[model samples]
Structure formats: C-alpha cells, structure tokens
Target: MVNISEKDIQLLQEQVISLHKEAVEGNAKAVKDLHQLLERVRSDHSDIPLLDAYHGSTMILIARDKTNPLDKLRWSKSGLKLLDGAVSSAPQNIMVRLLRGKAAYKLPEKHFHRARTAIEDYTFLIKRQIHGEGFLNTKRYWQLIYELGEVYHRIGRNQDASICWLKLKNEAQDPSFLHLLQLKLKLLEGKPSVEYIPDAESPISNLIRRAANATESELNNRLKQQKK
Candidate 1:
C-alpha cells in the first residue's frame, strides 16, 4: 500500500472538494487544474485505493466535457472500472465504499449489477451509522443517509425509503436536510407503505421481485441469528 503524509492527504482532500465544486459549476479551467492535481496525487501514491477512487471520480467529470460520444464512453468506462477495482480492493474501507456506491447509483440502468452493489454498500454504511460506528454526527454521515433513502426510493423500496427518511427527520438538525426529509415523508405518507409487488406479466419484473424477497429474507435471518 502506498503511504501518504497527513498533509498530503489533507491537500488532496481539499483539491478534490474544489474539483467537485468546479465540475458542478462548469468551470472548465478550474476543473482541469484540479484534475491535474489529482493525477499528480495518483502518480505519487500509485497504490493508494482512496486516491485511485478519487482519480476515477475526477475522470467522470472530465468525461462530461468530452464532445465526442466515443471519447465520453471511453472516459466513463475507464473511470467506473477504476472505481470498481478500488472498491473491490478495499471493500472494508467506508470512504471507498461510499464513493463507489454513490457513483454506481448515478450510472445508467444498464449497469444493473452496479445498482445492487451500491445498495449493499449503502446498507452496510447505514447499519454502521445505526450502531454508532465512525463519525455519525458529521455532515457526510447525514448526507449518506439521505442518499441511501434516495437510492431506496429509486429502487422501488418505498418502505425502506420511508424508514430512512423518518430516521433522518427525527435525528437531523440541519435545516436543509430536515426540510428535504419532511418533503420526502409527506410524499410517502399517502402512498402505500408496502413492498412493491411487481407485475407478474413481466418476467423481468417478477425475477427482480423474487430476488428482492430472497435478499430480504436472508437479511432478516442474519439479524435473528445475531440477536440470539
């Protein structure tokens, strides 16, 4: 494993934050500069999984600026592959897992396996937060919970989504998050609180339903075992 000084790590983190802000604001020159800084970090710490993941994320932003469809596809695929490798290599690293999960969640539906991977990571993170592990009171923790709720909502797990939102509503003090949680709760209130039952006529949907049910059953069984 490549080791980095604390100062270097802090600098990398700051640059990454700047990179994200610039990417969001479409500041091409700033994004380019930050991307170069990330590249230098990767070169210096070639074996660092976290840096690798961050580099991959930066690549995605770079891809957004590509004019050619093929170039865009190439960049996106390379970035995602790097992220996937980093996550696989450091499966227990919460930060790496969160990065991979969030990136995977934003990917297109054709990457179905990535969606499942994201869900698993988010579930593990949420469980960790619930058990008082790590920095549970931080902004990142709250944002992770909110993102998990959004993922659940996207994946047709309305009940799970509602549970996440309700938890956030009760514990969150940040006005921005609290306001969003309230809206989510209000939207979910009148809707059915049950698991989504897919149409039996669609084989693909039925398969998904069956798989979800099996996963839920396995999780419940594990929880029961842990309690014993």
Candidate 2:
C-alpha cells in the first residue's frame, strides 16, 4: 500500500480546491482535470473520508455536466452515496459537512429529498459558528445563511427564510451581498424587487457566484491541523 504523507495530502487538498473553483466557473477543461486528480486521490487514499467527500463533489459536478438523464441519475446517486458515507464517518468534520451541504443544496430537492440534509448540515455548521467552535469565516457564514434560507424557502419555510435574510441585512458588511439580500427579501414579501436594477451585474448571479466561492488560501487555512 502507498503511504500518503501529510504534506502530500495538503497538496492534494490545495489542488482539489483550486480545481473546484475553476470547475464552478463553467470551465469544462478544469472539470476534466479535477476528475483526473480525484481519481488519483481515490486510488491512493480511498479510506480517507475527507478525500472521499471531495471525490463525491466532483461526481456531482460530472453529473451536472451530463446531458443524458440516465447518466445524470446514476452519477448523482453514486456521488450522494459517497457523500453520505463520508458524513457518516466524520459527522463533525467541517469540510465534509460543507461539501455535502453544498452538493445537497445544488440538487433538486423534489427528486432527491436532500433539502433536509442541506438544512441539517448548514444548521450544524452555523450553530458551531455561533459557539465560536468552527472555522467558517464571516463571508462563508453569511453565504451559508443565504443557502440555508434558500433551502427553507424551497421547503415552504418562508418565515424561517425571512429570519435568515434579515440577519444578513442587519449584520453583513458586504455591499454586493446586501444588495442581493434586499432583492431576495423583497421578492419573498411579494413585492416588485426586480424593477429596481442594480448598478452592476445581476444580483442573482452575484449570489450564485458567492455561494460557489472557493479559494486555495481559504482551503489551506481550513485544512490545517488545528491545535488540540
């Protein structure tokens, strides 16, 4: 068996984050590259649940890129299974939860019934942030709130969604996020928010890009061995 070193794992993690960032940006080549890199990881360290989570996320990406319905369903289910296994193995692992939560959020809740999974993961992480126990920064915390609110809205929890959006409106510092939140809240209230155009790109796209945010520095920081 090949023994993967700590440094090697860190490098792999960095590559995974970098590749995933590109993949999220509609880069087809990057998606292919990510698949190859993850295949190598799976071959050498299939036992590592964190790596499995990454592989699972890549599978979801692949599924999204597929045009055939059967292929999409197959990949999505396989990816979800891997994500479920990883979470089952390390329920408290922040990265595992984040990957699975994001994947679950992207999935069609009507078909997968994974809204509850997304809600649970985001809620768990948010509670950790509240207790100052997790590594989520302000940006990610707010993003999670937005995603959680979205899931709530999908599941007919408008009041819960409003609470989340209101918290961001009251406390978040990012102007772009604030703009998007206002529109979302207005729309939720059955108001004509779309009539008020912003000075830049579409706020909905901004929110999607922000939700897909990933960076090597952020991943490196999160992947560090915390001092216990």
Candidate 3:
C-alpha cells in the first residue's frame, strides 16, 4: 500500500473543493475529473468521512450526466447512501452536514423524499452558525439561511421559512441580496394557497448562485495555479 502524507490528503481535498465548484456550475468535464480524483482518494484514504461525503457528492453530480432514468436514480441513491454513512459516522463534521444537506435539497422530493433530511441538516448547521461554531462566512451563512427557508417552504412550513428569511433580511448587508429577499417574501405570501416549488432559473436562485460563485474566489485561484 502506498503511504499518503497529510499534505497530500489536504491537497487532494482542496482540489476536490475546486472541482466541486465547477461541477456545480454545470461543467460536465469537471464532473468526470472530480469523479476520477475522488476515486483515487478513496483508494488511498478509505473511511475518511470528508472524503466519503465529497465522493458521495460527486456521485450525485454524475447522475446528471446519465442518459437513462434508472441509471440516474441508481447513482443518486448510491451517492446519498454514502453521504448518510458519512454523516452518521461524523455528525460533528459541519462540512459533511452541509454537503449532504445541499444534496438532499437539490434532489426531487417526490422521488428521493429527502426534504426532511435537507431540513434537518440545514437546521443543524444554522443553529451552529448562530453560535459561531461553523466556518461559513457572512455571505455563505446567510445563503444557508436562504436555502433553509426554501427547504422549509418545500415542506409547507411557511412560518419557519419566513422566520429564516426575515432573519437574513434584518442582518444582510448586500443591497441586491436584500432586494431579492423582499421579492421572495412577497412570493412566499401567496404560497399558502399554492405549493412552493423552487425554480432553479428564477432570479433569486441566480442571485444565490452568483453569491456562491463569488465566495469561491480563493478556490478558483488555487485551481488555476494547479492547472499551470
């Protein structure tokens, strides 16, 4: 067995994070690269909770490239299983929780029925963030709150959703983000009579996506350096 040093593992993890950002942004080639990188990591560092969680995330991303419905579902299920195992093994790992939470929320509830799981993970992270226990900076922290509210609305918990959104509205400093929050609140008002379904292409969703992209500046720079 080849012995991998801690520095090697850290670099691998950093590469994973960089690739994950591209994967999220709809880079198909990045998906393949991320999958290969994660496979290499798994071969070297079995049972590392962070690696498992990231590999699981890559599996879920790979599902998007599958042409067959059955294949997509199979990949998603397998990915989620790995994510669940990671969380169960390292419940205190906030990064694992956030990755699983995002995965659960992104999945369609009718098929995966992971809405509650998403809510649980987000809520757990939110509580920790409230206590300054997590690593999320201000923008990502409020972004998590926004995402949590969306999950709440998914499950018809309007009041809870409102609370989350309103809390962000009160403290968030970005003008554009605050404007979107106002628009979202208005949309939420009419949600009681209609089921709240999130549209990925919606303006608010795009804003959040942009915010996420902005937050990864450091990771993006590291990726560029790695390429050269």
Worst 10 residues of 2 by lDDT: 219-228
The regions of model 3 sitting more than 4 angstroms off are 190-228
**What are the per-residue Cα lDDT tens digits for candidate 3 across 1-228?**
578888988898899999999997779999999989888768877779999999898898887666655666778889999999999999989999999998887775545667789988988998898897858887778877887787677667788888888998999877877777787788778556335454422332233223332323443443333223
Clash numbers, per candidate: 0, 0, 0
Candidates sorted by lDDT, descending order? 3, 2, 1
- Model 3 accuracy (lDDT, Cα): 0.77
Which candidate leads the pack in TM-score? 3
User: Would you list the clashing residue pairs of candidate 3?
Assistant: none
- TM per model? 0.66, 0.77, 0.79
| TM-score for candidate 1, residues paired by index | 0.66
lDDT of 2 by residue, 1-228 (tens): 599889988988898899888886567888889888888768877888988998888888887777665666678789999999999999989999999998888875545667789999999999989998859777778778988987777766777888999998999876766777888788688633233313222332232223322322342232231110
Top of the candidates by lDDT: 3
lDDT of 3 at 21: 90
Cα lDDT tens digits, model 1, 83-148, are 888988898787777767766665433323355767788888877877878745566676667666
Query: Best to worst by TM-score, what's the order?
Result: 3, 2, 1
lDDT of each: 0.66, 0.76, 0.77
Worst 10 residues of 3 by lDDT: 207-216
Misplaced by over 4 Å in model 1 are: 1-26, 38-45, 66-70, 108-113, 174-179, 189-228
